[model samples]
Structures are given as C-alpha cells and as structure tokens.
Target: MTEHRHTNSSTGGTSPQLSQHKHEPSHRYSTGKECNASGSVTTPPRPSGIHQILCIPTGKIYIGSAVDLRARWGTHRWSLRRGTHHNFHLQHAWDKHGETNFEFSVLELVGTSDLLRTEQAWIDRTGCAARESGFNISNVAGSPGGIHAQEWKGFINPGGNEATIINLQKFCREHGLDFPSMHRLAMGKSKLKSYKGWTHRNSVRQREYIKTYDGFITPGGRPAGSITNLAAFCREHELDKTHMVAVAHGRICSHRGWTYATGKRKLAPRTYTGFINPGGQRMLITNLQAFCREHGLDIVHIHEIKSGQRKSHKGWTWREG
Candidate 1:
C-alpha cells in the first residue's frame, strides 16, 4: 500500500493556496420577487419647499419640521441603525413596514435662522405626533388659561417669567371685546397646581404657616389673616371688615394650586392675590380700580410680610391714617 499525506499551511511552504476572497454561495437563489415588490412601492426622495406629501405607509403620516430636508432623512437613517429613534409613532410605522414603506418630504420651510421658532410654527400648525416632548410645544409653565372659548382662541400675552396672570388689556384690545372682569377670568379656569390651587399643595402645614407666620401680615405691611382663620377672626374683632387681599411672594402663591378656592378655608376670609390679577411687569392699577369699582368694598387688605425676623405688630393700620 502507498502512504500519501497532505501537508498543512502552518507546517510551512503552502500546502495548498487558500482563497483570500470571501466564498459566496456557488448557486445564487433569485428572491427577485421580494426586491421587485419592495421596489415597486418604495417612495422617492423628497424635495424642499412648501406643501409636500410624505407617503409613509398606511397609518403612518408624520408631519414634521426641519431646517435642511436631506439632512433630516440622513438622521433618520442613522437613527434606524443606532435604534435610538425618538419619535415612537414613526418607529412603529417603520417596524411594521421598512424603509420602502416610509418617505420624508418637506413642508413649508420659513426661512429664519431661528430653528426653534420655525419648529414651533410647524408644531402649532400640524400638531406633531410627539408634541409633548418635541421642541417649542407649549404647556402650562405656571398658572392656567383656555377655559372660555374667547380666552382659548386669543393669545395669552405672558407678562412675566411666571405666567400667573393673563393680559386682559391686550386680549380686549386685540379682539375688540369689552375688557372682561378679573373675577370672570379667575372663575373661568380651574384652579391649577401651578398656582397652588390644587388640594395637594394646600397642605395643612402650609395653612398653619399662612395662619401663624408673622401673624398673617399682608404684603402691604397691614395685618391680614392666614386664610385658615381670617373670616372668624374678622367677625370676632368687630372691625367692620369689607374686603381683603392676600399678596404672596410671586414664587409662593404663584403655585397653580394656591387659588381662591384652595385659599378659602371654611373659616377663612375671601382673599385676592397677584395670581388672581392679570399679571405683568406692571400691575394694572386700572384693573385694581375696576375691581374695587365693581365690588362694593372699602379696605383692600394684604397679608404677607417680608422680614427675616418675625415680630408681632398691630393689625389693620390705615394707610392714610
């Protein structure tokens, strides 16, 4: 018998030259139907401009905002690989279909350097799918509005960083409607957490502090009640109290929950704070005068003091006296 042995490459001088190129399947199978089916329906790249339609498969129309049209699509492609797609609506559609089923097209690109403002306009116009987390989509930062139809349609002229009050003067002037009473506006909206009007914010501890702190000194240096026991106190004092105002720090009472509803304990007096007023950098003396005119009340009392040290003081000193 003749013995024959084959030498391996590791032993030395190549036994047989190994192919460096990748070995593919010798017989190619034609899944040409799959490619053709996907190809027949795949949408083409979209151009930039106003009023473009993106034929994103059935139940997947995502109207979006973008600075550059092509760049946005490129980002979507990368997002697919990284699997960090932020838009859940779009992702679900993509998962169900694939790249062929989706297309991104441009909608009116308002030429402005301000990308955020541009996006905000689109969001407001189209009502983006992921609006809650999307850029420039608005929600209540503080306070509330949109209870009435008129208020809902009209733009709220935010007065300060904290939107505690609506600018009724602007709303009236813009809409050509008679300036509504502050009380009406206050009554229109539900008490919100942003204003400390919610039951959760009106903790017993907060009421106790309001009741006892510096003896309920009003912001105007007059003695006021801690809404907890003000009315009974007034009734017992027999001072002929008519109306009262509780001026809280912009930060404190600005909590949406801290409303007249929450502030008015059964024993507490009716109280008005800056939150109840149309807020802005400047307080509307005209509005305040109007409120006083509308309501038959003499004394507008305040009930917050700003001293590091708490001291007892006589209540209800007349400003003129």
Candidate 2:
C-alpha cells in the first residue's frame, strides 16, 4: 500500500514524496476509508483541501484540490479504473506502471476559500505542469484564494431577461456587482449555477439558451391547468419542482400524480435517475450535485446514506434505489 516517503523540502526535488500529513493513501483500492502508510485507518480530511496523485515510477505528481477529498479521490479512482480519466497522461502512466506503483496523498489541508491560491502555490513549487515531470495539464490555477480575476466574461440572468452580455467584468463594474464572484460562476468553475439570480454563460456553449417550456399538474385526480412556470407552481402548491420536472420529463414514477401533457418531455435526455429519500419521502434525483446543492447536503454523507453507513442527513432519511 502506502509508502512513507518524506522529502527534504516542500518542493519535491529528486523523488515524489507523499508523507506530507501524518498519513499516506496506501489502500490498494479506495474503500471510502483512507489508510495510512503504516496501515492504520486515517479519516480523510474534512471540509476542503489539496490532494496529490504520485506516480512513483516516473515521479509525476498530479496536484488537485476539492471541497470533498474522499469523494474527489473516489471519483479519480473510479475514472482511472474505468480508463476514462480526463488526464490522459496520468491514465497512461497508470496503464504503463500498474496501480500499485501509484500512490495518493494529502499535500496540504485548506479551506474552501483558500483552495485555489494554495494549490497554485503548490503547483508553482512542484512544477507539476512540466512535460517530463508531472501530470498537471495546465499550470494556471482556476481561482486565487477562491476569488477569480478575469476580464471580458459573459453572464445571463436566469430569473430576469435571458439575454447574454459580452463582457461581464465591465457589466458588473457598471452595475456595481461583484465581478470576481460572478466570473467564477460564469466560467463554470463553481458548483453554484446561479449567483444573485444570474447564470454564468460559457463562451463555447449558450447554456442559458431557454426555450418556452411548460408542464401540467394533476392534483387529486383533477387537471390543475397548463403550468407555464414550473418553479412557481411547485412553490404555490407545496411541491418540489425538481421532482415535478422529473415527472414532466417522464424520468420518475410520478411526483404526486403529475405527468406531461404535451408528451415531448421524454425526448429531453438529461434526467434525474438516481433515487433518494429526502425527509423520509422517496424522490428521484436526476442530478446528484443539483439535489445536494438544493438541499444543502454534503456529498460525503450522501455516499454514506446510499451505503447504509449513514441513516439520515440533517435529520432527513436517505435511501438508495
């Protein structure tokens, strides 16, 4: 498993070191519980932090950080195992060297706001982006201390006019809004899709492109009416739009006996297919991240809920389907 390799300095010089914290990821496979170099169980760091993936054979380390380290690590292992890791170099290395030669470890524990800047410092120190050195694709950090600095950004308001602005920095300055924060959301870097009712539009894709969509609801076996606004309908009659949308899209069984009237919803391919029990009520979750964001639930606990390790999250029972 884990090798307790220490370095002379923070910037690794000769061989890649992984014994930064008191532990090293020596588990032959990621089992939700992280094991130390000495084979003792060490819980994965909490809140947020930086992590490193080290290829011992080539001394190439992939530096990354996440809001949830365990979940992020699980994702990395999952992707790498599936041979679909975004980092081709890392995947190639794993395919060449074998999984046993690669070890993952904690670089530095950081808060959510400090992730990017701290990671940048590590990236600069390690030079992980060097072609022959590491597996980092880009040397540029996504954020600086969780605050972004970019110009000529674009944004679209989800609630208001769905019009796109060419330059968000200038627009925010003229309107006296936070540009850095908006820029993060607009660049699709942050988890939150909207900030202050504004959705960040990517330059490559118009994600804000909205076509007129409506749904019908049947309350107590009676047609309520053609609901033009799904969200407002959910709020007015004590329903979750996420569920209602799933019903309209024909993704789930039903959200309180509601279905699509036009019957084109099934054509919408993206659907919430995961099942979750929120507040002891079973509902279909089309997007796990979206559901977690809406309910303010931590992803780590959600994993536990599905695995039966956790009974409830924030007093709401969750079940796997």
Candidate 3:
C-alpha cells in the first residue's frame, strides 16, 4: 500500500534479486521465461508507469503508477502470499480467489512526476475506489491507505433530548475522546453505550440506561448503590428506563428507585463577557445555548451582535465585560 505516496513495488515472485556480477546493475528476473543460448530463463529491466492487477474471475482491480512495475508486482505477491498485504480489501479478495485467477497489465505510461495525478485520474474514471466495486483500498490515487489508516465516519452526541452531529475524528481530538474506542463505538462495532457520560449522536444501541450514567438509587433519595451500566441494572431489576434520566437530572423528583451519582470534570472557570440585556439589565452568561433556550433568543443573532456583524439582534446588544 503506497497511500503515503512512495514508489510502488510489484508482487510477482520474479522480484529483482541482488546481482551476482559486480558490473551489472540489479535486474529483475522473470520466472525463467527467457534463456540465453543455453535455453534458460532471462532477466529483464523492470517496466515502469501506470499498471493494474486484475482478479480475472471477479473483475476486481488495483491501480497504481510507478517505476519498476515488475519489482512492485513482486512486492505485491510477496505480501499477499504472506497474508500481510497492507490493503486488506485486496488481500481478502485474493485469499478468496485463487492466485492464478489474477493477471497484471500496464495501463498508460507517464513520467514519475505525473504518476500520482494520472493514477488518480484513472481511479476516478474507473470508480475502483467505490466500496465493494473494486479492490482499491483508498480513494486517494497514490494512497493505498495502509492497514493502519482508518476512514472517518462522523458521529453524534445524543445527550438528553438534544443531539450534536460532527466529525468524529476532529471531535475526539478537540474533546479528548479515546479515538480507538470511540471509533469502534461510532462504527457500531462496540457494545458500549456511552463513554464517560458522552453519547453517540445516532447510535442505534443508545438506550435510556447508559454505561456512563450515574447508578441506582433508593426511593428515599438518600445514599444508594452504584453500578457500571444503567442498562445492566435495568435488566437485572426489570425496571423501566424511560424516567430514569429524568430522575437522574432531577427533572422528576424520583423514579422507581434511582438517582444520579455521577463524576464531574473540574475545569478552570470561563470568563464570559457581560452583555447588556434589552431591558437594561447586565447578565453574565456562560453557556450561550442554555441562555438562548432560557430567554427564547436566537443564538445566531447573538453571535452576529457579538462579532459586530450586525448592530443588534432584536433588542439584545453586545457589550464588553
């Protein structure tokens, strides 16, 4: 996989072996297809440029542009035979289809500088990168997206009744989320409901009782027992989860028997600019979303006023702290 942008090596067994003679440059030897007058196979300089390996039976294809097509093919075959191909999709297909079912052929010949661009054009024209359509492991032309690289699928934050939909990778980096774990969760590969009280925006597995939720409580609202997952607790007690969150958030005074005993992050305080209310009242607001909800204000208008894009929103005006 050359997704990181490097010359691609071949997968054929006829890889270039170290030259036995000191004067001759390293030459790639085919499997003895050509022979000297002695009637033996011959070695040939590797061909270069855009080439493709096709699974004849399945019609799957992998495209690349590189020098030393033979050497690149050798590397491909070496990795595939060892079950270590960086492009897992191609490897998987190869495992299912017999090795003899594949063939390598050259496409358009291009200079080294144009290899990536030309290859990308071919990939786009062929639609080889479409999922399940071809063997390509990356949409990027020269990028094979080695096994370690992951495709990002955005996620949602489904806390309370509100939800936040955003790029999962960027969100994880900004919010200090565990990328691997959250990735699994977002991809629907993990059974975990929530991580540290944060929820996926559109996870089908999301439930009223979450793993990161605070725990069970006694009906008296006094000290209660704790649990690792609310779902597990609900299952064990045959309890309804509909009102559990309400009780947890104090929206409902109490539910069957549960209270929120949750851990909280201690963070440095934020200095919010004091804004002059239309009624001539100065209010120090920290959470804009919450304030807008409380006063039935449009957040966008408030942002415009604060940024000086507009003079004011309705009656709200921006003022410095």
Off by over 4 Å in 2: 1-33, 37-40, 143-321
Could you estimate the TM-score for every candidate? 0.24, 0.38, 0.38
lDDT of each: 0.32, 0.62, 0.59
Model 1 alpha-carbon miss at residue 241, Å = 74
Q: Give the TM-score of candidate 2.
A: 0.38
TM-score of candidate 3 relative to the true fold = 0.38
Name the runs in model 3 displaced over 4 angstroms: 1-47, 146-186, 190-321
Worst 10 residues of 1 by lDDT: 1-10
User: How many times do residue backbones clash in model 1?
Assistant: 23
In candidate 3, position 318 carries an lDDT of: 79
For residues 153-204, what per-residue lDDT tens digits would candidate 1 score against the true structure? 2222211122232444444445443333332334443233112211222222
